[model samples]
Target: MMSETNPYMMVGERLCMDFINTVSWRESADKRREWFTSYAKWVDWCIHAEVLTGQQAKALLLEAEEKPSEAGDVLKQAIEMREVMYRIFKSISKDISPHQPDLELFNASVSHFYQTLQIIHEKDHYTLKFKQTENNLGIMLPPILQSAVDLLISNNDLERVKQCEGDPCGWLFFDTSRNRSRRWCSMSDCGNRAKARRFYQKEK
Candidate 1:
């Protein structure tokens, strides 16, 4: 379910899906609504940050609407955006190792993302499988899936990587604010929304 109060969070969650089936041309109106709602937030994040121009965002949205099979290509663009975020993470670190200082955490995060990719590839969306085996201490999840879960737990900031707060959004960005007060993946949308929400709440 998508919540207006936390649009960015919704986008984060949906990114794991290879194709946003809800918003694709083949989906129902309800699914389209859900997809657009989350996608709007994502586009807003990129546009506000200038990572993507208004025209680009609009075109992407149009593409999403017209070509359901192109969802994978759209996701690929998102992955490229994420790479920029990884670079930012590297820049901020003082560690000199060829591998990230937080290599274990990075591996975990990557593994989690990889597992999500596998799920997308295998199932075309999100699906969970649980199996119990005899002679086992207890139930066991697949190792790749476990690694993915562990990665998310290990890398706290993976969630904080944001999109801009602007109308037409661009790429994924990291929030390195001292107070972690960043709103937009780049501040256009996040900041504006924060201000507007505060004003509306105060009026009520």
Candidate 2:
């Protein structure tokens, strides 16, 4: 189950987009904050994102506790993958091709994802999952990577993809508005701030 109050918001409509937004104030020159500071926090975000079940998260956390070094390495890899993804999608938003290196990095992650694919039966249905072999935390990347690949290849409205207009907020999202006029990440946060700033400027 997910928490009622999370410091992070799921402003991104796509799973991959939400995963990329784990960092706060991503476009800021300074004062940026990382939400996935540790392996446990990363697992928590994964649970909240529904990328991992509660049981899988618990098992992973237990394994991480026993193997801190491995866990740390996985965390680093996850961060690196997230950054590469952000660059690729940010390029897509601008109608520019992703850098060859970024594509290669993403393809590597995709390759790893398929290597560990597994079929499991649960609750009267069968689903594909990454086999949890030895508590390797990098296993988390495949599903997230697949989400990005799906978004890139799908016919879903790519024109609706947008980066928030909020200064220092570089979160990418699919604008699901009928008119495609959505702007800020959230109206209660950046939207309200922008409105207040406009009012203040008008009164000056």
Candidate 3:
């Protein structure tokens, strides 16, 4: 069930970017509400993001409940990975190199992700997919890792990546616009707020 006050915004064009954006406001010196407060919420976001099916989400939730401590540890790991990705991508957005520690952390996740890779026989072609097993937490990570890997390896894709111009809303996104002029996380949210602020300043 979705929370009445849930703030899981998905403004990023890419899955990994959206996941990094689970943190509400990035440029804010003070912290904001973290969307993935628990393993269940993370599962919910995965379901909302279409990363997991209803049945898969239900099973993961059941497993989490059975092993609460393990679930917490996984959640902590997820958040740590998320922050590392955020820093690395933010550096990329600025055309700067990511910190060594962040790059090492990302490589560790990538190494783990590659270990689960498998080929699936689809209707016409063999598609690559992660091997789903009893280690649900580990299984959940590869798709997100793949998204990051895909963006990092593509020069054009990396060039289109941007950080939102809205103050304190330092979310990253893939600028899918033809002109690559996307400057805000969302026109309805930060964009409008910025415009309103400009209007108020002009009047003053």
What residue runs in model 1 are displaced by over 4 Å at the alpha carbon?
Answer: 1-40, 80-92, 98-204
The lDDT values for all models are 0.41, 0.86, 0.86
lDDT of 3 by residue, 78-154 (tens): 89998999999999999999999999999998997788788999999998888875677645678888999999999
Task: Please provide TM-scores, in order, for all candidate models, with all chains considered together.
Answer: 0.27, 0.90, 0.92
Candidate 2's TM-score:
0.90
By TM-score rank, best first, the candidates go: 3, 2, 1
User: What TM-score would you give candidate 3 relative to the actual structure?
Assistant: 0.92
Ranking by lDDT: 3, 2, 1
TM-score head-to-head 1 vs 3, winner: 3
Off by over 4 Å in 2: 1-7, 118-126
Question: Which pairs, if any, clash in model 2?
Answer: none
RMSD, candidate 2, Å:
2.4
